[model samples]
Target: MRRIPVRSLAVLATVGTLVLTGCGTETGDPADSTPAVAGADRTIRAHEVMQLTKVHEETGMTLLEGPTFDGTGKLLVVDVTAPAGKPKVIRVDVRKRTSQAVHTDARGAYTSAQFSPYDGRLYLTDYAHGEVVSLAPDGSDPRTFFSGDVDGARMNPDDIAFDEEGNLYVSDSRGLSTGDAHGRVVRIERDGKESTVLAEGLASTNGVSFDADYEGLWISELTQNRISYLRLDGKGGVASKHTAVRVDGGIAQTDSIAVDAAGNIYQALHGRAAMVVYDRHGERLATIEVPARAKGLESATNVAITPGGTRAYMTVSGPAGGFLYTFDALAKGVRQSNGG
Candidate 1:
């Protein structure tokens, strides 16, 4: 391993400063703002605040996203190569802190990935190939799980998740593309079946997760600076959505989301250098800050959790490539509700 250049470090250092200062657009009046733990109903109260403890190297040429724990608690993450290389998914042994590439394909620029609880295998979304790939647990033998032709649409997939019954849900964001540029959320069943759209005309649907109870889908609209909830009829296939949290005029560009068993929502505030959390009803709970300056927290792009939600994992963008961060999920008090 070689040292990262000082110039790049300077950029990241600046982002860390901005993160501590004030990130996100400020909106609304004092009435809607409350200390997540203060005014939160007992139902939504966060019992613990976990702090991120660095688990592995955050410096490298690999851009990591879509992190999740396998049944054994090992962390599996997708590595999107820089402009010059192919995409690969790697598995990191949390206990050992060692990582190895499991699979790579040049035809697609993989964005986000997830491990299917349905079969304990890995599923990935590729913007370049316009489809999702299912990789064996060993990271070999990739297969197409679903594609746009069946859904009547095509866009870059930013993230993905599955329901209790093994139905696949995905967020399709039209990244930097022309013509409306709205994003979509789609559902595909385990047997390779497609359903009607969950929601459409979105502004940058990046990170997504199902509610802890598995009844609704929680989605993050990055450019819109807010999170939404969709009540799903996973059985009947009807999708009704609603706004969960509205962050007024805050900064946009959210990259990933994680949910604890308590129904608290966590977001990797990309371009903000902050990991934000919210109550189930959409109240801003806490904003956990990290050190990343240039490109705002190095675009703290993805987040994952250890089994039982005891720990959380995140990756940050680097001027040269990227770095990874791990933290205790429920540690200390959540960041001052209003930056006090």
Candidate 2:
């Protein structure tokens, strides 16, 4: 339902329309609106799994973003707001509730991370440098992997995903802040030699995750607070796409996203300290929020379901600092939820 003119109706030429496939869902007013994720599928009270930032930030606050599982079941997260002296990438021990540094570039602000199943290397998106860098599983051999461009314009990449065949898809999040259609979903070929703009013309593309079958993509556009399903053409490009879900509320923007084995989408909200679980059809399943006692935690920036199960961990941050919260997921975890 339209809470208040959430987005502009203008469409962009660079974007692929779902009208061709007749599967596109559009935003509507509350009077004629599609059912919003009313309250939630189930109100799940998440407990404190671990804390990364400080309880009270008398100085600077840490903004924790990406939360994903590496190959060996380590909970990896990124401090997008870390200063020079702090670790940008941190790996957590799920069993013991401990943390350790992975890697961080002095000049780069990495936002999201994923392990490439194809090559078994950890790939991270440096939002500040417009580059995708890779490191070994143990956080060694850090190097610039993909700084490719789209239509000759430098990409302000946000999040990333890898297809079954190893094609890298990125969310180019430079949107309204620059101009219309600047936001794009670019595909960097598996070989890393060529890149293509799979989709474009949006607000701010944030989350990037592939469907269970690898034939479609689930993307969240932040400025508009909506999520769309991008059906692939099977050759590393989007065939058609449609607006599948929209998060309507006060100043709430969608951040990172994860998909479980059954294809449920776990999307985080930056302004609100809660995560929404939506089915493949864009129906809301649950809303996982920190209990009222957990004060100072402002937002749930990103979430990752524990590999092989429904245990979900969210990377939260605010004036209280960065922290990790746990929840019982709606379905089993899969490749999409574990990776980036």
Candidate 3:
């Protein structure tokens, strides 16, 4: 198998930075401040007031992505250090402010790992291997849960999510360097059968999440710098689709996303160095800024809201190093079906 060259991957990595910093007018003037909440009488400057605490910091790790809470309240994150070193999943104890490796042997970079409510198992995306793997909640009993092809093409699963019925949805980002429109969102049935739900003109599908009401599936397209919501038919197929939110300028590369009980959407804006919050109607609510000069914490790649939604955990990756950060959230996160 021919690997996408590291240099090409680097080019893809820089897309967010260039879009966020180089695109003028798209971001507007930094001084032109406006209230985040629609129709609110007073402006709440969350970007300037929210305090961010460094939870865990590590050197030598290049890319950090995916973040989910375990049943025990520990946070699990993937270090996507491909070609340079073996990727591993690190488990963090939020209260203790400590972290440890709970799972290794990625075979390829691990993009996302989600716990299932029905079976009490961890489902992870093996990006380079084109498969989804499962593990015991404690990171044991690793096995391939789904692999091979989807819609007649290989899978490069980047993110995973589960519905109330226990079915799994995965975002397959075929490749980053190429401009081919091969991105797809696939569903793994309760019985393990796979089907493609959305596969049309997507440029590197990166994230997947369901709304609080379970009425729509939200996805982030990295290269396109937009997030969309897909209304699904009763039979696990897309009924209709529409753009929910888009990064107009200043680093439009949106990565992973999470939702709160109040229907607020938390998005990782890679190039802007911030996590953005949006109402269910796709209106901008707040911007949680991640410091740009923080040695190893440059880009915000993924976000996970804890069970109560009172706090949010984010992963930052860049040349300096990889680290996990946490901060108080304005809204409570919706509890996952599995109690994660």
In terms of lDDT, the best-performing candidate is 2
Q: What is the lDDT of residue 101 in candidate 1?
A: 64
Q: Write the per-residue lDDT of candidate 2 for residues 203-300, one digit (tens) a residue.
A: 78888899888879999987778999899887666789999998873666788788988888988887778888888877788877776666676678
Against the true structure, what is each candidate's TM-score?
Answer: 0.74, 0.85, 0.80
lDDT of 1 by residue, 162-280 (tens): 77566777787654343243778877777766555678878667777877777887887766777888887757454687778776425535566777767777776655455777777
RMSD in angstroms between candidate 3 and the native structure over all alpha carbons: 7.3
Q: Between candidates 1 and 3, name the one with more favorable lDDT.
A: 3
C-alpha lDDT of candidate 3 relative to the true structure: 0.64
lDDT to native, each model: 0.57, 0.73, 0.64
Off by over 4 Å in 2: 1-40, 55-59, 176-181
Highest TM-score scorer = 2
lDDT of 1 at 86: 37
Report the lDDT tens digits of candidate 3 across residue range 72-126: 8888877665432333777888666677777776144577778887898888777
